[model samples]
Target: MEISRRRFSALGAGVAATTLSGTLSGATAAQAETPPGKPAVRNVVLVHGAYADGSSWAKVIPLLQEAGMNVTAVQNPLTSLADDVAATNFALARQDGPTLLVAHSYGGTVISEAGLAPNVTGLVYVAARAPEAGEDFAALSARFPTPPVTSGIITSGGFKWIGRSAFLRDFANGVPRKEALVLYAAQGLLSTAAPTTSVAAWREKPSWYAVSKDDRTINPDLERFMARRMNATTIEVDSGHLSLVTHPKIIAGLILRAAANS
Candidate 1:
């Protein structure tokens, strides 16, 4: 299902045209403009990564809702890749029509497994992992200089998280001070045995990526490499790892682009 660069270029051009027209409002708008027999995407399923929950998508959710999209933010268990993917699939199954699957941080890994669902038409990775099938994301990330936040991850018993200090300084650096503190207090943790994937849906689905230029959680270079390798439509934002919070408009715009293109 790998798309040729030429095909992606053509797709990107079409998306750019739709975006410029400013007519997209949701699946309805896409449907009205679509050529016969094309899928119209209106549903969006969001997945959050380690150290966060579904609330991580709070900012982007309202924006998408205002655009007339039916949005569902999944509450991943973060216990294992299988459990998280199951949670995403549960959300995906409720979508009435084609859906745009969006992921942040480790949530990207969840969507990589669950996005193969029949209703999923596209994927948007926001400063998130886009591991190839059978690829070890940790090993892949090792190719780039490790981001400072990785060193701050603290594991106890079987779960992993960053302390409030590390969360504020490294994980949510660009976030407002007060809000970063709140996010730290509500931090989630991942199980020690969370597995990587061998079935990345981006292989067949059209994908978009948002790279945080100043990201300290995941290296920007690593994000770029994964985006390029997946042939995703990529947008770069100058923000921290939590770009979805700091730059909701940009992330929502990318999702809309994926919706139009789907």
Candidate 2:
């Protein structure tokens, strides 16, 4: 079944389907079709996790562009799960053909809810939380030993973010110091409720995963469990939670592999 345009509205989040219109224009159907022998999926939509903006995908975007793929990185509002899913759905709605939906960190949750879009053909989770339908990610992650970054969270109002020191030391440890500093500076504050939404698009879609072996923010062990649970095509990389930033080449490659399969 398709994820309805009224999904968030049905949940009392008040997100209007018309909000998707601005991002919904794209290539004609013929131009959007994948060339023969190329990946069956021609569009790639990226969703960024908590404490990040779409710029979080900067490192991977050019690589995908160089490979001749149409790519769009979603700017999640980080206000709530429903809002983030709405933003992601807006991007997915714009794709003209088969599309590969990719997520990093908390973005995995957003894609899990939005990936049911009719044109979404596959999912790639990069060191992300992949909770099953009716699962509570916070409770799920709690089953694993708490990671270092958990202690660094600073909640203000209803939004949360890792402290700068923790963002650099625990979350983005694999990233270069200078770059990590900039990422920390641009971090988005995330709603605490996002993780409680239990939808699992990976359950219905062919999925791939890249687990960051050295991840301290989301527990590498938890990543493995989720990857296994989804029966995803999985790979492990030596990196921190922000693998998409620190290990873009392999992450992008995995995404390409998922796209090719579509």
Mind giving the per-residue lDDT tens digits that candidate 1 earns over 19-104?
23333222111112344575557899999989998888898888788777899999998888988988898898888988999999
Candidate 1: where are CA atoms >4 Å away? 1-40
TM-score per candidate: 0.86, 0.84
lDDT of 2 by residue, 145-228 (tens): 999998899998888999988999998897889999999999999986646655788889998888788898999889889988
- Residue 138 of model 2 has an lDDT of 78
How big is the positional error of residue 118 in model 1, measured in Å on the Cα after superposition? Answer: 0.8
Q: By lDDT, who's the top model here?
A: 1
What C-alpha lDDT values do all the predictions have?
Answer: 0.80, 0.78
Q: In terms of TM-score, which candidate is strongest?
A: 1
lDDT of 1 at 164: 74
- Candidate 1 lDDT for residue 90: 89
Runs of candidate 2 exceeding 4 Å displacement: 1-39
lDDT (Cα, 0-100) at 88 in candidate 1: 91
